[model samples]
Target: MPDLASLVTVPALLASVFFFIAGSVGLVRMPDTLTRIHALTKADNIALGLLVVALLPQVGSIADAAKIVAVWIVVQISSGAAAQLMGEVALAERDAASSGPDQRGMAGGRDA
Candidate 1:
């Protein structure tokens, strides 16, 4: 019979792949930058976490599993920060475009 770890690992990995694909689709299909970032970040984060979970059972040592989890955590933090920064920039650009040209040069639509 197949081992329990193998059974668990396979499904988790497959789910992770599914989420990664969903994220890519969202990136292409979303209407705007903010929604795109939201979809991609959320999906990718879950996919990465599931990937880490799948890998934990297969690693040879505790240290290897710890390293995998650490990498996942780091990627999660960095991706979230990057997504927030990108969203902010997109909002700023959108606002700039919506505002009249004369207001665009000024900070916060005021004399600066």
Candidate 2:
């Protein structure tokens, strides 16, 4: 018979895998960079996070759990920052492209 730990770990791992698959599907199907970021960050992060938490029992140490949590937090912050930057850059480029040639240069009597 499987031990309690194994049973728990198996289900948690399965859940994590499902989350990852869902995230991947979202990434493929979602339109726009912003939506993709949402899919990748939230879905994948949650999946990986659950996996880490599930493994905590196996780790058998408070220090390991703390380290995992710290890593998760860092991932959350960095992914959010990256997504924000990507969105900003995409918007800026879109704005610039739609704006056509620089009117400021034309007004200043400089070559565009």
Candidate 3:
């Protein structure tokens, strides 16, 4: 029979892989940029965190685990910020595209 370490790490790693696959499917099936970002940031980040957790038991020391956790935390924060920025840009692009050159400014003394 396998040991406790294998039991924990195996499932955790499997879960991480599942999340990554789900995120990829979501990205392809989704309609637009905002949705894709949602899939990636939410699903992929979870996958990354789980991957870190799975590797934690195999690391040489507690300090290595701490470092992994720190990296994961940083990734979470940065990904959230990036998603927000991408969302804003997507909205801006949509607005600009809808406006068109003529609608943007029809001129002060001209009629539609």
Candidate 4:
């Protein structure tokens, strides 16, 4: 008979994989940069948490699982910061292009 742990682990792992696939699709199909970042960060973080849960039973010690969870937390924080930074950069670029001086130089100047 299959052990209870094995049974539970299987589904959790599978769900994690599904989340990964969904996130990937979001990245490919989303219309814009910010939306893509939202998909990747949120979905992948959930998937990572699920993966850590599924892996806990298979690991030799509770300490190992705790370590995995800690890593996931760190990753989530860093990735979130990265995504925010990228969004800000994109916005700045957009603003600069939209508002900057024209190719003709000063606003009152005419073609040479």
| Overall lDDT per candidate, in order of appearance | 0.88, 0.79, 0.85, 0.82
* Residues 1-112, model 4: lDDT tens digits: 3387788789999999999999999999998787898898889988888898898778777899789888888998898899899889867766665556575355753222
RMSD of each: 4.9, 5.8, 5.2, 5.3
Between candidates 1 and 3, name the one with more favorable TM-score: 1
**Model 1: ten consecutive residues of lowest lDDT:** 103-112
Candidate 3 residue spans exceeding 4 A from truth: 101-112
Who is ahead in TM-score, 2 or 4?
Answer: 4
State each candidate's clash count. 0, 0, 0, 0
Best by TM-score: 1
User: Which residue pairs of candidate 1 clash?
Assistant: none
Q: What TM-score fits each model?
A: 0.87, 0.73, 0.82, 0.79
Cα lDDT of model 3 by residue, 1-112, tens digit: 3477777789999999999999999989998888898998789998998899798877878899899989999988998898999999987876666565557664453321
Write the number of the candidate with greater lDDT, choosing between 3 and 4. Answer: 3
- After aligning candidate 4 to the native by TM-score, how far in Å is the CA of 19 from where it should be? 0.9
Clashing pairs in 2: none
Off by over 4 Å in 1: 101-112
Between candidates 3 and 4, name the one with more favorable TM-score. 3
lDDT assessment of candidate 3 = 0.85
- lDDT by residue (8-79, candidate 2, tens digit) is 778888999999999999999997677787898889988988898678666767998889888888888888
Q: Write the per-residue lDDT of candidate 1 for residues 24-96, one digit (tens) a residue.
A: 9999999889999999999999999889988888888999989998899899889999999999998888876
